[model samples]
Structures are given as C-alpha cells and as structure tokens.
Target: MPSFTVVTTAQRYEAIVETGALARLSEFLPSPAAKVFVVTTEDVWQLHGSTVASALSGRSWHRLLFPGGEARKRLSSVEALAEEMVSLGGDRSSIVVAFGGGIVNDLGGFLAAIFMRGVPVVQVPTTLLAQVDAAVGGKTGANLTSGKNLVGAFHQPLVVLTDPSVLHTLPEREYRAGLFEVIKHGIIASEPLFRLMQLERPSVLARDPAAMQQMIAESVRIKSEVVSADEKEGGLRRILNFGHTVGHAFEAETSYTRFLHGEAVGLGMKAAAHLSRLTGRLDAPTCQDILDVVDAYGPFPTLDGIQTENLFARLVNDKKSILGRVHFVLATRIGATEVAAGLAPELIREAIASTLR
Candidate 1:
C-alpha cells in the first residue's frame, strides 16, 4: 500500500492508495461507531455498492444515494443528506463514508462537519478525479447557484481510502478529466512528475495498474505536502488553485452543464499560461510547454458561446478574490507559480479571448 499523512492544525489523517484497498475499509475504521452512513450516487452504487457493503457487512451501516452529476451538487442536497442522517438515528458518534466522486465527497464531508457539530468522515473516492484531488484536501462543500464550491468548509476526514481498481470502471472521458489535476500537480510543483506524465501517457490512458497507481500516489503526495503546509489556502496552498480561479468561473458561467470540472480546469490552465506569457513572468516557449501538456489531454470545452463579460462577472465571486480584486495563480515556469493580485479585469478577458482564438 502507498500511503501518506496529511497533518493540519485541525486534524491529521492518512490517505491510503492501492488496488483493492476498499476491501480493507473495516481495518481503517476499527471503532464500532453508533452508525455509519455510506453516501454515494445511484450510478456508483450500482457498480460497486455490493463490494462496499460486503466490506462493512457486519457493521451498522446504511447506504444513502444522491442524484449523480454536477447539477445536483447543491446546498439542498446537503440539507437532505443531513435530514436523512438524523432520521436514521445518527448522533455525534456516527461516521460518514463518502463513497463516490468529488460531489459525494464534498456533500458527505460537509454533512459530517455540521450534522451534529461534526463527525468523523472516511473518504472512499471512486473516480480518479476524486482520489487525486478532491478527496485528499479537507475542502468540502456543495455549490450554490452563484458559483462552484462557494459554500464549502474546511473539514478534514478521518481517513481517505482510494482503491485504484475502481477506476477501471471509469469512462475514458472522466479518467482523462482526472488526469488534468495530475498534470496540474506536475506543472505547479514537480518537473520530474511532469516528465513522468509525458512518458506514461499511453499506459495511463490504457489504465495499466502500475502506471495508474504511480500517478495517483504521486498526485496525492504532492497534494498532501501542500495541504500540510497551508491547509486553509492562506498562502502556499493557494498555488494548488493554479487554474481554478478562472476554471471555476467557467463552470459557473455555463451553469455547470457544459463541461466536467477537469475539462474546465484544462481550459483555465491554457488561459493562465497565456496570461503568464503576456505578463512576461513566463517566456513563450515555457508557456507553450504548459499549453502542449494541457492540449495533450484535452478535447476541452469550447469557449464559443461563453461570454467574456459573464466569465468576468463570475470571476468577481471567486473565493480567492477579495475586495473586487481576483487573486490569480500564474506559472513562472512549468514547475513553479506565483499569485498575482489586482490584475486588471481586461487582462484576464484578453487572456480568455486568446483561448477562443
């Protein structure tokens, strides 16, 4: 098993990544809790619920299903899940097993945090995206109509169990979407990781076990180290939001319907690279290096129908923005980034426009 510990001021937890790791769920949660709620989506449950149920066969557990897809990740879903927990006799000692992709992880984590002033959560992320990014960080929340993750909280989980085997069932589009985060990790912190990604592209897309495992493990390690240093996104951790500032705005402007989260982030990375070049922080060659890696993984969402003004309007509401100024993360090089604040809105618009061209 490949595992790492994420230490934050609030709590410390281990993220376990390996094939068939889901079968060892009981070992991870040794305590006999009052009850356990396994929150997931109907699609995911249909595929792997039996295995999950078998893992917790002898325990007091219940499976709670939510509608799948980004559209259903809303505050109302959180409220409903909380209500379900209460009706099922949940208490402070209960545990929440967030057992799907990012949406379930966010919803379940938020539910555990506020259900009874917080309960322990165990993240069992199914999709590649969830395992690599969303599940590791304590950032949890449902989206509001206004923006993505605009209503989330910083609630760490008791443990995060990532079974790489589950990813074999992931659709190619979703798997590729998850790869964007791994590429982002490489671009933001590790040149070696970036080269590895470039080398392993075929095996990664083929879902080769060793290749997939290494990608997931390395990505998690990078995220764990960053979260440990700045768990709350106050400083160094903000770099992890590399393409998210604009990526998230794209999601919101399109009503979360047009692209998967990773696809949007892919487009955002292109815009960020363009901005980096335009501002002279990164030369054209390095900027193209970043763009080439992003384009390699993308048939990214088109910006044809999306308006720059609408994107700018949504950008203003980004959590990273403050006092009418957006805090943008721009790469100085392939493996480095810096936060640029108070960038004129026109500069961002022009960068986005370049993407359309």
Candidate 2:
C-alpha cells in the first residue's frame, strides 16, 4: 500500500477505506463514553445503517434520518438535528457522525461545529463526491432560497472514513456525476493522476474496487494538500473552486433537482473552458479536450433559452460575485486554471450558451 499523508493545521485523520469500514465505525470513533449520534438520509439508513449499527452492536448509538438530496440541507433539518442531539443528553463531549453523501456530511459537519459552540464530528462518507471533496475540507454549509450552500460554516471532521464498497450502491448517473470531481482534481493538481484518469477504461471505473480506492484516495490527497496549505480558503485555496462558480448557479437555477453537484460542475467547467477559449487564454483544442473528458461520462441536460438567462442572474447573486461583477474560474489551458473577476455579463451569457450546444 502506498502511504499518503495530507498534513494541515485543521486536525487530520487517516481513512481506512475498504469494503467494510462502515461496520468498523465504532472502533474508528473516539470512544464509547462520548454521547454519539448519527445523521443520515432515509435511503442510506435503509441500505447500510443497520450494518453500521451492527458494527457497534454492543454500544449506544442514536440516529436521525432525513430526506435525501440537496433540498434537505437546510436550517429546519439542522434545527431538528440539534434538538435530537440535545434530547439525547448530548453535551460538549458529544459527536455527530455524518453517514451519507455530501448533503449529510456538510449539514452534520456544520451542526457539529455549532451545536454547543463546538463538538467533535466524524464523517463516514458513502459517496465518491463526499470521499474526495466534501469530507476532506472543514467547509460545511446548506442552501437557501437565494442559493445553494449559502448558509454554512467551516468545521473540520474528527475523522473521515471512506468505504469504496458503498459506491457500488450509487445509481449509474450518480456515479458518473462524481467522475467530474475526479477529473477536476487532476486538472488542478497532479499531472500523473490526470493522465491516469485519461487512460481509464469505463469498465475499470465501474467495476474495479482497487481502482476506485486509488481514485478516491488520490482525489482526497489533492484537496487535503490544498486545504492544508490554506485552511480558510485564502489565496491558493480558491483554486479548488475551479468549476464551482457557475456550477452552483446551475444547481440553484434548477432548484437542485435536475443535476447532481458533479454534473452541474461538469457543465460549469465546460462553460469556464469556453470562456477561456473565447478570451484567448486557452486554445480551441484545450476547450475541446476539457469537453471530451466531461462528455465521456454521460449526457448533461441543456441549459438554454430563458434558463441560460436565469443562470446568469443567479451568478450575479453568487457569494463569490462582488460589486455586480462575477468572479469566473477559467482555465489557461487543459492542465491550468485561472480566476477572472469583473467579467462582462454578455461574455458570461455567451459561455453559458456554448455549453447547451
């Protein structure tokens, strides 16, 4: 096994990712003395919660199940979870185990960060997106009527346990949605990882457990390295948001129902790539190269006509925007990325249009 480490001031922990880590979460958590609670989606609970409970068969465990999807990452759910923990006699020593995908991890992490001012939290990420992105960084938040992840806080995890075997349960579209992040990590950081992704056959990504583990581990390493250098998203940390600017807007415009995070990001990256090419920062071939990788996974729905206009309006409201100008994350080339602010709205509209074609 290749020993990898991402050292950061934000307390870090090793992830023993394998087929059965969910059952072993009790051992991975701090101790049985601490008041423990789990927050997960009903779907995830039905699929693997019992096995996880069985793992801690001899211990006391509290669970709160919520509806699945980005829609549930809200203040109401957080409020409910806070009440749940409080009713369980939770104190400062309590811990919230996030036991689902990004929505659960983000909300649970934020809840753990704020409830009782602060408490330790464990992340048992069951999806590829959570294993690589959401679970690694301390950044946690929820959506609002204005935008997605508009309400959130930054609270690091006590530990992140990744079980690749759980990924097998992901729907085909969901699994393909996560590949966008795997491609993004390579685009922003490691050249070797990028090349490996380019050479991967569909069968390998779909069926090879060892390959899946390595992919998740390497993607986590990229995000962890960046987060370690700038824990609070100062300077170099923003590079991780390469495709998120427009990605979030696409998510919000659809009310987060049409596309998953990765799928929206896949389209957003293509828009960013087109902007790069139009602005002469990247060659036409580079734009096509980015599209090739994104298109390889699955067909993304078109965002055209009035929806395109609406997405641009949503961008204006994005937290990253300032003084009515949007800060767009674009690429200088296939393996390079750049951020530009005060971009013309007309140009932004044009970029969004290109993706639909």
Candidate 3:
C-alpha cells in the first residue's frame, strides 16, 4: 500500500493507496458517527461490498446503489440518493462514504453537502481517474440536463482513501483513460513527470508501481498546492481545468457515450495545442511532441467523424464563456499552460481544426 496525504486550509487528510483499504475502515473513520452510509454502484458493491460491510460489522450501516456510468452523474441521481438517505434516517451528523470512481465521488459528495444542509462525507476513490484528479479537489457536482457539472457544491471530504489495487479490475480502456490526466498534471506543473512520459519506452509503466505511486503523489501535491492557493477557483485553480474547456464540450457533444473523460481530454489537449501553435504560443515541434505522447498511449477517439461546427456551437455554451467570448486553456509548451480568454469564435474554430487536423 502506498500512502499519500492532501493538505488544505480547511483540513488535512491521508489517502492510503493499496488493496484491503476497505477492510481497514474501522481504524479510519472518525468517532461519534450516528450511522454510516455507503454510496456506491451495484457492480462495485457486488465486487467488494462484503469486505467493506464486514469491516463495519458492529456499526449501523446503509447502502445506496446507483447504476455505474458517467450519464448517471445528474441532479436526479443526487436527489434520489439524498431521498434514500433521508428515508434511512440520515441526520446532519450522519456520515456518507462514497465508494466508487469520480462519478460516485462527485454525486455522493454533493448530496452529502446539501442533504440536511450538510453532513460529513468520506471519499474512497476506486478508479485511477478519481484517485489522482477528481476525488482530491473537493469540487463536487452533478450534471444538469442542459450541461455537465451545472449543479454542484464545493464540499471537501472529511477524508479520502485510495486503493490502487482496485484499478486492476478496471477495463483497459478506463485504465488508459486515466493516463491522460496524469499526463495533464505533468504538463501543468512538473517537467520531470512530463519528460518521464515522453522519454520512457512503451509498457514501462506496467512494471512500475513505485513510479506510479510517485507520479500520483506528485500530482496530488500539485493539486493540493493549487487548491491551497485558490480554494474556490478564483485564480490559480482555473489552471487545473487545463484541457477541460474543449474536453467537456467533446464529452457533451458525444453525449458521453463514445469517449471516456480522459480520452476526450487527451484529444482536447491535442486540439488546444493546435490552437496554441496557430496563435504562435507553441511551435509545431512542441505540439507534435505532446501529440506523440498521447498517441503512444494509444486509443484516442477520432474527431474526424465529429462535426467541428456543432462542436464549436457546443463550445460557445461552455460555462467558462463570458461576455460572448470563449476562454481556452492553452499551453505554450508542455509543462506550461495558460488561460486565453475572449478568443473569437473564428479563432476558436480555427484552433480546433489545426489541433484536430
């Protein structure tokens, strides 16, 4: 088990990233909880629910299961879970333990934040995507029918426990999907990490748990640093959304059925790089290098079939757009990214073509 910690002004929590963490919950939870609720999916509960339940053998426990998928990260789902908790006699002091990936963490965390006004929640992230990115930020939300993450709250988890061992059960596509965010973190903060992905031979990551743990720790540290500086995304926190502007649009445009979040973001970063080159922010060689890294990871969903015009129309509706201009997060090069606000629609369209071409 690899251990990691997140330090924030509100509080500090430790994440134990290994197998059997669910079995160790008795030692991890805070005292004086009236009841414990595990928010999860049926599949997740089927796989490891008994172990978790066994760990809390002496305590009163309730389980809330939702169908597992990105599409379920909605306000209705949040309301359903909240209603279930209320029906189960949840109180302000009750604890919610989210036991799945980013979708569960986001939905469950948001529900815990609003149910009874507020309640303490624990995050047990089971996927690589959640372990490194979404679960750490305390940026919890549910997608509205109109847009992704449209209804949400900023509620930090009382604690987070990550078990990388759980990732072994993840589908290959989903596992590789997470590498995109890992690569994104490297590009934004640590040059060494960026270079590691660039220089290492293919398949090196498969044999290297220590390397993976180190990368996750560094990425978490970068995130913690950013959150510490700007908890509410007033300034530095926006940097964390590096590829999200275009990426989210791509996800929404496809209705999230075709590309996983990280896969779409990987392509989005590539598209943003093309835009950066057109604006002279990045040279062609630098753009190719980043694209090469993404390609080396393989399995990028094609943008050729997606209608660029419709994609741009979707971009115009992005939450980041303000005053009739879309803001793009662009990189001058790997290891450096910036927000280019108020980009004209024409330029934004051109950038997408150049990067996705």
Per-structure clash totals for the candidates: 0, 1, 0
Q: Candidate 2 at residue 280, lDDT? A: 79
- Give the Cα-based TM-score of candidate 1 against the true structure: 0.93
Q: By the lDDT metric, which is better: model 1 or model 2? A: 1
Q: lDDT by residue for model 2 over 1-357, one digit each (tens)?
A: 232344567676564556667777888777777878888988898888888888767777788776867667888888888988888898888888999999899998988988999898888888888888888878888878766787788787877888888988888777888888988887777666666667784654665887787777788777877887888876778888888888988887876777888998998888888888888788987688778877877678665533777888888888777686777767886556777887767877898888777
Candidate 2: the clashing residue pairs are 141-152
Lowest-sum lDDT 10-residue window in model 1: 143-152
Query: How would you encode candidate 1's per-residue C-alpha lDDT over 1-357 as one tens digit per residue?
Result: 789999999899999998989988988885775688999998899898888899998899988888866668888888888888889988888999999999899988998888888999999999999999999989999877765677878999999999999998899899999998998898899887788777777787899999888889989999999999998877999888888888888877887788898988888888899888888899998888888888888787667788777887888887778787888889998789999988776788898888667
lDDT of 1: 0.87
Ranking of models by lDDT: 1, 2, 3
Candidate 1 deviant stretches above 4 angstroms: 307-314, 344-347
Ranking according to TM-score, highest score first: 1, 2, 3
In order of appearance, the predictions have TM-scores of: 0.93, 0.90, 0.90
How many residue pairs in model 1 have overlapping backbones?
A: 0
The residue-level lDDT of candidate 1 at 44 comes to: 93
Provide the global lDDT of candidate 3 against the true structure.
Answer: 0.79
lDDT of 3 by residue, 104-214 (tens): 999889988898998878898877788888887788998777767878888888777776666667777877888888888887888887787787635424725655666
* Backbone steric clashes in candidate 2, count: 1
Best prediction by TM-score: 1
State the displacement of the C-alpha of residue 75, model 1, in Å, after optimal TM-score superposition.
3.6
Question: What C-alpha lDDT does candidate 2 achieve relative to the native structure?
Answer: 0.79
The local distance difference test score of each candidate is 0.87, 0.79, 0.79
Query: Regarding TM-score, does 1 or 2 come out ahead?
Result: 1
